[model samples]
Target: NDYGKLGRAGEAIAHSLVSSSAAGRVAYVEPFAPAPGEAQLGARNDRGLLVFSGCGTPPTGQHEVARGVVQVAELNNPVLLNFGVSEVNWWLHYEFAPVCSRTVLVAYDKLAEWDMMAPRKPVLEQVRAQLLASSDTVVGLSEGSIDDVPDASYVGHGVDRHWHDPAIDSLPEPADLAAIPRPRAVYVGALSMRFDVEAVRDLADSGLDVVLVGMAPHPALVELAERHPRIHLIGERPPEQAAAYLLHSDVGIVPHTDEPFTYSMEPHKAYNYAAAGLPTVTLNTAHAPALGPFLNATRDRKEFVDGVRTALAGGRLSPDQVAQARSLSWNRVAEAILRAA
Candidate 1:
């Protein structure tokens, strides 16, 4: 229902399904609560697509939201694609499975064991296990994730081929980004705790100007930026603006920490950077290699800085690397999901 952006993995999936020729009359449901006094329920129609924007106080309003979902299910008996992990409201919609043609759970992230979600580890794990056992089909985003869940098939995350356009290379340097010094190592995502604070510091200490192009409300990132004049936080931007920052950059960097939670994640930013023709450096997570030839994964901060230096020298992604990134289109991923169902 939120049409403003399609950057997140689940939102991208919803968009791909709606855009696919094989899909008919697809419905996208967003359960985020609106601000006080705003409309609680909103429905938008886009040709064959129907989006339901739901609003309610969660936990208290879970029943209300689930009932709304159930009503939609009863009317269409649509195939349910559950993205729920730890949310009880999403689980409540499971009762309406009998009314749907089929139910498929997309395990896009590692459950419970992830660092940020560790507080609800037991509940998340139990719920995920239950969904894996009960859903008509289960699709894991990585091979490692499949090993963690029984009977789960792998359907890795995808990128939009449109990002590979040659036009992106020609886009003028964004005015704010132009102010940053050359050989900028760009990380274009939320500056969360998942990023190694010391690793980022190492880059700044090494005299590399680090450019972070997303929300930087995370205290560590805020503190890091305050301490290092070389580090630039461009703040959150629209997709087009973010793409310009990536496209005009010298080298793309994913300085994420090596953690059990990140084992199943293949950062979509790596794909974006590669597609935009930037040579990329990332931390060596279990699934990071799948990002293809444009990426050089490292084990430690020293190796990470070395990789960035190498990427800076090597310049942008080669034609072959861009070709590999182009192959990871969301249309293909959407078809794979539908085929799995």
Candidate 2:
């Protein structure tokens, strides 16, 4: 749990920035800007009333509320920038002095200063250097890493779990679910290249409607989607929609490949899937151990598919089982963060 610093940052900001009614109710948008029709956090000081506010780019939209309202937007369209970021991306994180004034950069955790992947050094260094070069404002960020960010204030991750877990109102009709054959499975996050390969293929071959619900990692998955009707790739659904699906689903699948990122990272869906009563099926790698009760680790393809079957044979989730998941409530998350703050 590394006690997730960015999560803390987002939660802290969500609670601290907005007004009482909208504070907890507002959204947090990272790399993306708000749609004109969308209400901006810049608009009001709402703390808790409505949660349709904005948040950008979530590593996992597993947090309790407003997944769709949250996004990752950059001031500059990354595509147009040829995959590079501009000044505005750094500014949105925090407000600062004149030279660096009007800019606040918030960062996710970094592995090390030397590590190229951590946004800590590369991003902040460039920004600060540029700001210092200007001599008009002081650039700063709220962070934990000792990167060359120069002046960073450590702050709690902002997490608003207060609005999570509304009772399912209207259920999806049986016919919609009747179509989702045995081994009720659903994936709720992006289908990145980091996904398990031969394992998913095996599951597809097994005829399980591997109800995928996010972006595709590769064209091969698209081809698999065509050939294997079971590989149902439904691009990202709203958190509520995904939660409902998981409520009825037998097992949650996170057939992730063993990669450095997978090992070092915590998969947010694993928490939500489990919280939604779906047991996870992942690789028996180092990271799997931390998942505790939620995980079903497998070493190979046959085992991976078998793990799903095992969860299915174990039977549909009992009410108690689902209740077990509810224990990891976003409220619990909120409390932890507030106490931390």
Candidate 3:
């Protein structure tokens, strides 16, 4: 499936990289049913690279066809096989190995802890090792994530500066957000298991207008929002619209649960909030320290509550903090990756 709006950080990164860079082209291959009349082997685009879809679902067939497509594409143009997932697709990787010019593995999360359904842990470990061994360069989302990989580079996620700039004060506030009371704490991103619903509940229970701008309601989160009148699930908005909410809101929050997955993740929202010049508060995690003074990293519930209150009281980020955030733009990230490639 195409990477739609409002999910998958890796997909967002890929889109940003492709759109911004002058790289020849990007041939995206996905494991889903192809559209009617779509070429099974290869296709080309006048604007940029062609996308070959429908590589067949697992436990069936079509692996050979996908391999052939990749081999043909590589021979004609430089091929960069970038793997964003932790688990290695053995068949696909092995097929592309001979033709790929450079292999890049992006470590966005902990593989073992992420896939709880998998019965065997050792298999994942072996896959990770094999993937890393075959990769020419390892790019980690956070510093802690790259420690195990040999010759890894730490490239944190970046925000789109043009869309998310703090200087865009002329933009009108989102209509739903305008109705909400001031001293607002806005949380943008997926409301998943990692989200600290209880903490958000606490903020709502404290009479603060807690606005959630994301995809949908996590069942548990839905329950909390239903219970509290102050908790506003504004639903998903476009990136530009979301930036407006952040800029106009009192404070931005990163209310994620304390878990292993969060430890290795450098939440892209953190940078987004910072770039918008919004006072940010987050539950303490491995990547929190690197965020510097721009973010308020709270240890527990009490601290989180207090941090929100502190942010609501009208704290501002230092000039250096703003500069630091602006420096981590998607354009710079794409440039660095292209240079390395």
- Top lDDT hit: 1
Where does candidate 3 stray beyond 4 Å?
7-9, 12-22, 33-49, 55-79, 88-91, 115-120, 161-168, 288-290, 314-324
Clashing pairs in 3: none
Query: How well is each residue in 163-254 modelled by candidate 1, as lDDT tens digits?
Result: 74667667788898888888889888777668787888999899989999887557988888998988988889877668888877889888
- Estimate the TM-score for candidate 1: 0.86
With a 3 Å backbone cut-off (N, CA, C), the pairs that clash in candidate 1 are none
For candidate 3, lDDT tens digit of each residue in 269-308?
A: 8888887777788885565444676788776877898888
Q: What's the CA error at residue 228 for candidate 2, in Å?
A: 1.3
Report every candidate's CA lDDT: 0.73, 0.49, 0.69
Task: Give the lowest summed-lDDT range of ten residues in model 3.
Answer: 54-63
Total clashes in model 3, counting residue pairs 3 or more apart in sequence or in different chains: 0
Best by TM-score: 1
TM-score winner, 2 or 3: 3
Give the TM-score of each candidate: 0.86, 0.58, 0.83
Score candidate 3 by lDDT.
Answer: 0.69
Clashes per model (N, Cα, C within 3 A) = 0, 45, 0
Q: After superposition, how far is residue 113 of candidate 1 from its true place, in Å?
A: 1.3
